[model samples]
Target chain A: MHEALRFQPVDAEPVDRADVVAKSRHLRRVTEGAARGLSLTIRGLRKAFGDNEVLRGIDLHIPAGQFVAIVGRSGCGKSTLLRLIAGLDAPTAGGIAFGEQPRAQDVRVMFQEPRLLPWARVLSNVEVGLGRERSSADAQARAERALVEVGLGDKRGEWPSVLSGGQKQRVALARALVSQPRVLAFDEPLGALDALTRISMQQLLERVWRDQGFTAILVTHDVAEAVALADRVLVIEDGRIAEDVTIDLPRPRRRGSAELAALEGEILKHLLEGSEDTSGL
Target chain B: MSLIDSLPRVGAPKLPKVDGLIPWIVPLAIVLVWQLACVTGFVPSRVLPAPTDVALAGWKLLLSGELVRNIWVSFWRASIGFVIGGGIGFAFGLANGLSQLSAKLTDTTLQMVRNIPHLALIPLVILWFGIDESAKLFLVALGVFFPIYLNTLHGIRTVDPQLIEMGRIYGMTDGELFRRVIFPGALPSIFVGLRFALGIMWLTLIVAETIAASSGLGYMAMQAREFMLIDVVVLSILIYALLGKLADSASRALERLTLSWHPAFQKK
Candidate 1:
């Protein structure tokens, strides 16, 4: 029990291979099992904007309730891939299906900017994506429920204008969940917040993921964020998946823990140097 | 509490909150000065009636119910025209805002029509509709249309593209997208059009009523001018000012009601 307080200089424990292997196996099993159960299949997704060719012959599959993070340099088509999956933009070719269903509306994306309607109250903004004919009271109740899940239940009547940056993002998250979508996609949702706020938000996101089981795909530039939240981190380079690292850290992970830090360093090394072969150990 | 302690210690200087009396002071001072000048006979009565004479004329007209009748007629005509014209303008503006095809089809023609002054069309309108209430209504409608259309179109076009993309990614359909993202995004501009349309409607009504109309404040002013009833003329002008003040106040209240969620309307 005393080891829990500080195990740094006095008792620097050696890294446990059994612990790492257990965490990795557990996360991989859960995700792989979800894939088998949900049957989400992606085959050769190609997206082009004019002649830019943002996503070229890309392919990826996110299992149900699995947190997959896509990290790459800017303009590497990570955002384009997320957008295509979210149905905000149509793919030039190829297909994505949810258990043989070809519809694109099953996915929902949370943006980096909250994009809350300035005129709407926090509750209404959260209710925006709810169907039109649904009663305002129903929407409000759902929004309130979602906010409660996100730990922001008391701020229903507050205007979006007055919300802090972090609070606005929470509202956005609540909005994405209000529909109870099967697939939740995030496009660098915490990119704009301060460092402390980003860490807190990352923790909130992990907690939310734990509570609500849905397929989550996060596109981000931050290697730490990917390592902290994702079941597996996929690095996109030059319009393709360059590396897919299965995170070997246990849940409720600390930020400065040696295991996480080592994983961060390894991921950074792969990101910084292109074409590094990273076969699983 | 001492002045320094009681006063706001932040930002700009504290504006005196004479609250009730603040708005009244300038107008009251102007009236007092005018009344004093007239009472001292600094101006001839034929050229400009004393404040008392104008007040008495106002009372006589009020007693006869003519002032209220004319004001009511003008108000009804202007309001109906404003609503109809403003509605059409708002719809067109939104259409133009969202679709490039609509913009391509209507932009040049609308711009051309906007350049034609509603007053300049007075003769043509009079010829077509025969100096009747229809002509007056048409005039007001035409006058109110341009400002509302311009503002609404500007509002819709200026909506942030990033927000619209976010709405789409959130699984919002087209109608929901328009209502949630487009409409609210363009509301401040819409309000500008609404308020501008209202002001221009009042102005157009007065101008329309002035030309060959047997009833309304503008007609009364013209009739009083012919008879050299300068006090009645002054009272008519005063009535116009009062009506304008009422329209402006109502529009402002509507703006406040419609835009209460806007940051501009929020209390510090």
Candidate 2:
């Protein structure tokens, strides 16, 4: 039911094929004994804040290792849905279950703001991802490795205030990836970045997501970005999934390609039409 | 790139080299004018002694070790009071800031007590502890307590809720959250409170010592006034100014060291 929707193109980048395979194999080995990616099953999730129904009823089933993008207007409850899935906020009704009963450390959320501890050094901030239970030496080793993964090894000792906006986001991504989580949720993480920085961060995110093979759910308002990164694009409207479109585009998909543009246009059309209908009602 | 090369070159106005010496010029000129007035008999020497007289008085006090002894006594008293009051204030602030139950139990009472001008309680303190070291210590501690307590509470209360939420999401326990997120976030404000409390500490000490004491600089100044020793009185005032500046500088240095992660403290 999901193979056609899945885009695992072996020839995505012929030159990097060997490197990708080696990294993915190593990643699999590391996560084999540990709790790997977890599949999400959200049923009739409703969240109301003092009679303001943010999420009317959200039902989303995201399979393990699948990348999903939720796109919607400002108040269309996409963020609310993401927050519920990340377990930051509880649903007013219904339930969300993970396949393996994921621990708090097994899931991580990256917000639009980097949300780095301003007082902590870059390495320390990333080490916080290991939770308070891990040994100091082990956490330090993993944190350094995560920083190196995000191309920030040299910046380990530096303070967050010293880093540029993009660098700060990269540190945040490193922090999220340090735990080797089974589920990674992005709440418009790139929304505050500049256009150029956003694209670079998108590429970095894609590379990490592909390597880690975690269940990734990105909440974004940027249609093009949603289409470019996600295997399946979900258009949320009136706190419901208005349209579920699968982007068959292969990995390492070109930015601003005609095919991606067409998909964006199709998604935007659905979103615009849905808004109009809601307004008319 | 070299450090100097990395510095901004374009549109960066060069600072005048002579600017460093400019501050001394005004003070020196003031001193010269004062000496000239004294020499020319424009002002009575008895009423307002010349700068030289003040320096000579300082020199005499330095030789007799009286100035150093008085300063040391005052410093020790201030230090003891500051540690006691500041420590208690910090503990109370943390308690009130963290738990609503604690706040409900104590914050109102604290606010009510804070309203009573601690200096105004000097007479009561004297009556309770007598005109001894305990009276002065009590006054100084009482005076220093409010600023630290109030600012610490404000600091902890005003810490970014988002960061605290992030800490919670990251699975930090209560202790870890306080140590990592809440405490560091509250530091800048706590430092502000410390500096304010230091000023209050000195002010209270001076007043307490002057009103009833035998040894401190304030007491020495009072003694000098009784003997019509204008130079000694002026020297004591200058010493107070110096001590205040030193304390402030020390706090600022600590602020710079601890808050290096803060953008406001980062060098351009």
Candidate 3:
């Protein structure tokens, strides 16, 4: 916070930029080394729909509390991987194991469509994320806390139909977070939002992840989003993890900064080449 | 919240209470023209009674308590028939909607029976049940069945699968999934079926009463026609119209009450 105030007057001060970056790392590291998130291990993760193999023999481990972004072209099985990780779909061949025997609410997925109940009030929708504990006394309080975390406290009584697209997604996020899942998977949750709203949503996602210390797996088509929010960006090509790049950047990364743009460009190059390699031949 | 506040909400303008009189104009004008024609000798009372004559007949029937008695009988028949038919239809609909085996076993046969008009079975129903209360019940129940069944099935089938999926992911059990996701999602279409059935309910009741009944508006109207009492017949017809309107209004009130969350039902 002090870093933002100090950098307020210096329009493009290079020293201010470095200091901001350094200060933001302090913001990020607050949750970086916490053991609050569960570690995920996948082995020979294979999925096929009929004869179509969407994912083939994927093996990877995500350490506890790391934010990972999966990026690829459409139909690249990035979402498929995330779904398998979140246990939304059963993997045909392999198994996924958390570091421990996680509870039912240990993992939650925020779908692209928000998937809110149109009949339910915003607070009730969030309370749904409490799973079987929904009937408990503190459920409403917990749901309210989650809503306030997403900056939607006033929307508690509003119907989901009345909300804007971005607000609905925020409600969905609050629902996902209400359960305090050790692993949160997002399936392009912000893809439907306007560009400016998408950026703000991305920041909200980052803030919640930092505050809660939960491992986040975001699958998206935008390479820039992958670099901007994730500690590690995994590139899936031809149903495989083609490249895994560790983004050692600081928190609160600027949208159009040199470091982020270069990483995004490099990932985009790999993605474009992967497209040509399959279709060109 | 600021963003939502800044966004323009979709709301229709509030309707003033005086606008309620707008719908009465055409009906009132028709009555005025009919009364004028009757008074001027343009139309004979033998063919059609004037509106005032019908009102006078209605007042006489009300003082004798026959109007209320017949209305009560008809209303009772409609209610009982609707409950029986709607209950059975809802059961079949829910079964078929949720279970593939149930749908496969009975849906084709039900569809075949549905294709045969229930009113056309009136003679057959009379033969089978001897023009008794059961015959009336059979006809009215049969008439009210299809709309509720078809719409209930459709509503259940069309519930957004994505919402169901989300419910499953959030650790909803089978019962929870149905109650929280499937049932509420199917409610709007179920209400549509209910309204349609209410219309059929009144139509079938009138026909059943006209066929053979000791009491009811239809019976009174038919009996008055036989005696050449034009005013009494017209009064019965008017009463039937009012009863139909009342049933329709009741169903609409229910839709508004339950479907308050629905955008189409909400008023500014």
Candidates sorted by lDDT, descending order?
3, 2, 1
> What C-alpha root-mean-square deviation, in Å, does candidate 2 show against the real structure?
4.6
Give residue B220's error in model 3 in angstroms: 0.7
Model 1 lDDT per residue over B84-200, tens place = 888888888988988999999998999999888879998899899998888988888888888989999999999999888777765578997898788988888888887788788
Tell me the tens digit of each residue's lDDT in model 3 across B142-250: 8888999999999999999999999999999989988989989999999889989998998998988998787889999999989999899899888888888898888
In candidate 3, the residue pairs with backbone N, CA or C atoms under 3 Å apart (3 or more residues apart, or in different chains) clash, namely none
Instruction: Report the C-alpha lDDT of model 2 over A89-111, residue by residue, as the tens digit.
Output: 88899899999888888899999
**TM-score of each model, paired residue for residue:** 0.84, 0.90, 0.91
lDDT of 3 by residue, A1-281 (tens): 32443223212234444444434644664655376699989999999999999999899999998999999888889989998998878999999989988898989999899999988899999999999899999999889878866767768998888888999999999999999889999999999999988987887798778767889999998889999999999999879999999999977788999999999999888888835654321
DockQ of all candidate complexes = 0.41, 0.73, 0.70
Which structure among the candidates has the greatest TM-score? 3
Model 3 DockQ vs. reference: 0.70
Ranked candidates, highest TM-score first: 3, 2, 1
**Which pairs clash in the backbone of model 2?**
none
How do the residues B80-135 of candidate 2 rate in per-residue lDDT, one tens digit apiece?
A: 99998998898999989988999999999999999998989988988898879989
**With candidate 3 superimposed using the best TM-score fit, by how many Å does residue A276's alpha carbon deviate from the native?**
5.3
In each prediction, how many residue pairs overlap at the backbone (N, C-alpha, C within less than 3 A)?
0, 0, 0
Chain A TM-score of each candidate structure, as shown: 0.81, 0.87, 0.87
